[model samples]
Target chain A: MAKGRELKGRIKSVENTRKITRTMEMVAASKMKRATDRVAAARPYALALGDVLARLVRPDIAERFPLLRQPATTTRVALVLLTANRGLCGAFNTNLIREARARIAELEAKGATVELHVVGKKGIGFFKYLGRNLASERIDITDRPSAADAASLIDGLTDRFAKGDLDAVYVTYAKFKSALSTPPSTEQVVPVVPPATQGTPRDFLLSPNADVIVEALLPAYVRNMVYRALVETVAGEQSARRTAMKNATDNASDMLTLLKRTYNSARQAQITQEIAEIVGGASALQG
Target chain B: MAGALQVSVISPEQVLYEGTATSVTAPAFDGELGILPLHAPLMTLLGTGTLRVESSEGLKRFHVAGGFLQVVDDTVRVVTEEASLVG
Candidate 1:
């Protein structure tokens, strides 16, 4: 009887845990949908920006823009590492940190001085524990990132790059390929790589000139790139979290089932013992 | 549709407007520039001011800041950093 009672307690606790995991799974699923929608909504602006850039980035025209000027040699580089502030998202932060560390090592191997700018609480904590120097640490910008947020981050980086203080700027984050896949990747943000000309260039009347327009456009372009990275990283975080929560919920369900089976068997054993005791008493009384 | 130009106003967050407009007046870096149908292909830096789009329905104005305006093939695309409807 005691064993049956203990089994019932175990089952009840497992059922309570299952309820919590189920709720978490639902919450993550909803958040993932919203994040994915944000990613989709931001696509047209990026494409439009790309279209404008493609038309303006001829070799001769690009030479006039300081943002397009490649450094003579890469001496110093900045790596902006993006991770999540919260960490229930299984291996998401871990994979990103590992990838960032590898990139830093590679950059160091090439003799470039790397300035680490971390953008999440988890990344900051890990690096701090490792006693690594951080150029800047930010944990404020949450899931919903605005254009101003991107502009703020780009302002300092672009100023330094324009002033020749930094040779190159690279951003590392998880690129949202799909809901199921997010791969850690890095892209160079400075010395803007002009996309190849697609078709015949149209003769557009430049207001001031291509050079002046490009001068204004490059900064905006850099900000947009940073914004894209931030949004994609958020989407990836949600996706990772949804997957983790789903697995957790599933595990909880399995545990509950196993516990229920064990409880039933314990109850059956208790009942059998009770019946056996009653039968022995009857036989002894008859004797 | 022949007289109207297809206009898309897009920001980093959302597509504020996408439709046909008979005319568009945007704030260029220097001053306000008005674009009508069959205008030449043009590219100009945008400034912070109201972007007015007039169609058969009515005139819609958006407070736009810091981006670019591109006109090609009777299609005008205004890509701004931020755009919101003026109250």
Candidate 2:
């Protein structure tokens, strides 16, 4: 009986863990739903803004814009990598880092230098191990990031681009596809390039003037791009946590099932042995 | 400045304020600048401070931080750094 005590204790511990993992799974599920909705709600506006901005750049103003100008060298690129502030979800940060490293290598293959702008703490700590200096980053921008915060960061990126300190700006994050799937993505942030097949801009009124309107829309465009990525990253994080918890729950349940089987077999074997001993003793007494 | 000018304050997150107002006053880096209806088309970089838009009822104040201001045609668009309306 005491020999099986260790197994019993192990089972108890596992059950406790299963309870916690189950709770975590539910919590992650709720968060995943909220984050998914947030990303979806924000998309139409961002896409509309992007499309509007694509057309707003008049040919003349485009000539003077530094962001539009091509750089002499492609040696150095600035990567703005976004990851969750804390670690728990499996492979979330790892996959992002893997993509970022590949992107860096690709840029380097083009003879460009690479700089990191780590958004979350995990990225900062990871890149620091390789002796990289982050151009600029914001931490603790989880839950819902304020539009202003996104704008402020874009302002910094704009400065770097204007100064020609960076050849191009890139952002890497996990794009939320669904509750079960999110893929890591690297996107170009600046030079305001619209897809070739973009639709025409609507003829909205020029409130103050056309130039002012364009100017207003440009920064908004930048903010939209970054905020969308951030929101998507959060959603991806939640989904990853949910998936990890689900696996843990399933594994625990399997372990408990196996233990129950072993426990029954062991109990039956002990009962049979006891009966045999009692019968043998009675026969020996009668003899 | 015959009538109220249509002004919209937009951020990346959402459209903060969009309506018609008699005048718009903002805190610029050097000083405060006011925009009126049919104001000359121009653009200026905004600094940190509160922005005010006036109407017949009263003046509404919005807190804003670093961004730019632009006026084109007759519309005044303030793309603020950080914007919050007075409660």
Candidate 3:
């Protein structure tokens, strides 16, 4: 009886866990759809921007643009580590943190002072635990990151880079390739690197001339890069959460099945033992 | 269709319009610029104002701010980060 009762309690607990996981999986699935749509929706702008840049920027034209000027020697750098605030999502946060740590290590080894600017509470907590110095910590941006949110995150940093206070800035995030694969990658955001001019350049009537336009466009370009990274990181987070919840639900179901089988056998054995005791007592009374 | 230009109004969040337009009037940084078919390759920074596109369906207007416009051959692209449809 004791064994049977204990098994029943175990089964009930597993059932509750299964319910929670199932709900989480469904929630994550819906969120993933929206996040992926954002990814697609943002593509046209990126393409059009790239189209304009490729046609507009050249080595000679970019030479005068401060943002496009690559630092001769990278001495001071800033790294923005993006992680999800909550932790239910598998290794999503872990992978990003690991990647950021390695990047900081690599930069420091090269005699560059790495300034750690972290977003999301999970990353902040991890760094705080290690007593690492953080230039800034922000937990305001959620899974749905807006352009304004991105601007707030990168504006000050870019201004510093332009003024030569910082040599370079890099962002570390999970690159969403697909639902099945999201690898943590680091991308340089400052000292804006223009894509190599492709094909033959077209000569167009420049509106405010090339110099001013390129200067303004480079900052926008940097903001776009940061925005894109945020969007992709969000998508990857949701996908990872869904997969993790799905696995959890499956495991819970399996555990419940095993517990039920053991409970049934324990109940049957107790019934047989009681019957045997009754028969023995009756035989002794008759003798 | 001979004189129609292929036009696309693109914003960061979504594509506002994509069709053939007879004419397009964009608010360039300095002033308003109009385009017809076979316009020479041109690029300009956009200011905050109305963007009017006239097509077979009728005229489509958008309020766009702080972006750029490009025209090459018969293709025109109006890309703005902040844009919304207007009556």
Pick the TM-score winner.
1
Per-model TM-score versus the true fold: 0.97, 0.76, 0.95
On DockQ, the candidate that comes out on top is 1
What is model 3's native contact fraction? Answer: 0.69
Per-residue error (Å), model 1, residue A277: 1.5
Question: What docking tier does model 3 reach?
Answer: medium
Please say which candidate is ahead in DockQ: 1 or 3: 1
Off by over 4 Å in 2: A58-60, A131-133, A136-138, A195-209, B1-11, B14-87
Model 1 alpha-carbon drift over 4 Å, by segment: none
lDDT of 2 at A219: 57
| Tens digit of per-residue lDDT, candidate 3, span A1-287 | 88898899999999999999999999999999999999888888878887778777777866677787788999999999999988899999999999999999999999999999999999999999999999999999997998888899999999998889999999999998999899999999988777766666788988988776676677778888888899999999999999999999999999988999999989989989998899989999998
Model 1, global lDDT: 0.90
Interface Cα RMSD, each model: 0.7, 6.6, 1.1
Task: Indicate whether candidate 1 or candidate 2 has the larger DockQ.
Answer: 1
Prediction 1 TM-score vs. true: 0.97
Model 2, range B43-77, lDDT digits (tens) per residue? 66667888998867678888887666666666777
Question: Distance from true position, residue A98, model 3, in Å?
Answer: 0.5
lDDT of 3 at A252: 99
DockQ of each: 0.89, 0.13, 0.75
Q: Candidate 2 at A140: error in angstroms?
A: 2.5
User: Model 2: per-residue lDDT, tens digit, A157-245?
Assistant: 86778788777888898988887788999988876664443654345433345555455556566667788888889899989988999
Give the Cα error of residue A41 in candidate 1, in Å. Answer: 1.4
